[model samples]
Target: MSITLVLVVVMAVLYAAGVYQMLERSLTRILIGFLLVGNATNILILLMAGRSGLAPFVTDDGRSYEQIAEEMADPLPQALILTAIVITFGVSAFLLAMIYRRWRLANADQVENDETDASVREDAAGISAQTTADDRALDVLLESSDEGTAAKHGESAMTDDRKEDR
Candidate 1:
């Protein structure tokens, strides 16, 4: 098969794996997904440049320029990829730091199962309810002189609270 075709297939597989890993709840899988995407992007750049040829430095009778320019592999993509890799590395490090914090808080590397999910859901619901109730009371107190205004303010506050929760 052609190199371009092979590279395309590889990039597709990497993208799929990255998506799957990102969907996982564990932070580690998400970081790995990001890494896979970074490498795949680099490979795509390489494929775009086509196959490498002999260095363009040497000339007839073995003459060469001391400050050869075009002889190197397309240095632009390589330079771009190098910068991307560094940025990816920094992002990965930050992700690791966040994961470490989560682990410290939960004392586990793996994400907890249904019980944890349920508790988080319940806590979120309770917080939502409390915030809504508080907003309603505030709306009544602040707009108590006008019935229509109080109702509108209460409705707006609940909508704002929902958006904040999201």
Candidate 2:
């Protein structure tokens, strides 16, 4: 097959893979899809530069050639791809960091939308401020008393009772 056709096929496959990956739930997979898409774009650009019989750079024969003279791969596309790669790396790193932070906070990978209406209703009804300082203090006191009673009975007391009943 011609180089152009081969490149076009490669680009199409990469694009399809990228789209499929983007549809996945995992953020990591989405990032991989983005990278694939970026690569496909670079490949398209390189293909469009047109095929020449020789490289664009100077030769020892001293023909004094200008850039983009013949069949050699274009250096500009390569440079642009490198820059795009760096940018994509930075963006992917930032996205991963954001996902990590969200996971750490919520203990889940999926994004959760907030129920603002419920929150607003609670706020309007003064439910948000219903738990007073005294109630909180009492909860703490009760919890401490429960723990003290447990400690007094010994940690294995409950387990021992179950064994005796059995």
Candidate 3:
């Protein structure tokens, strides 16, 4: 039932490093952070799970149900660890693919600042909503067009369609 000091410290270090790495701009760093955090979480769950004992499925011939239950190791923490491992693997794989693609396409691992984020910052800085509905609609239309959303249904997305439509 007692948790070792060393394990607790390791978990703490993992969490700290994971969080710090997660904040980095590099996709590889983020993946490492995610893995660290997942491992730390697994460690935490294991520590909190208490002493390991006999499997819950086994039943002694003469032992009472209460005694069997007391000796049974909790399955919840083990399941959680398994689930976390799976989620980490899937997400890391996706991140790896994205990193590879970025590297292949641009020869860079650094993520560029998205223009949408910049525009959102500008809106938050000061955009008056006190204007008329017509102005707001026009603004939405213009912004969507600028982003190539083609808010207008008649606008064809492909070159061939464009010739026919226009």
**Highest TM-score model number:** 3
Question: Which candidate gets the maximum lDDT versus the true structure?
Answer: 3
lDDT agreement with native, every candidate: 0.79, 0.77, 0.84
Global lDDT of model 2:
0.77
As a whole number from 0 to 100, the lDDT of residue 29 in candidate 1 is 96
For model 3, residues 49-117, the per-residue Cα lDDT tens digits are 889988878665898898898889999889998998899899889989988999999998777899999
By descending TM-score, how would the candidates be arranged? 3, 1, 2
* lDDT of each residue in 23-115, candidate 2, tens digit only: 887777887898899889888877776554554566666554554355466677667778877887898888889878877887877645469
Q: Over 4 Å off in model 2, which ranges?
A: 52-55, 66-73, 113-166
* Model 2 clash number: 4
* lDDT score at residue 66, model 3, on the 0-100 scale: 87
lDDT of 1 by residue, 93-150 (tens): 9989988998899886676679988999999999999999999999878655564565
**Lowest-scoring 10 consecutive residues by lDDT in candidate 3?**
149-158
Candidate 2: give its CA RMSD in angstroms: 19.6
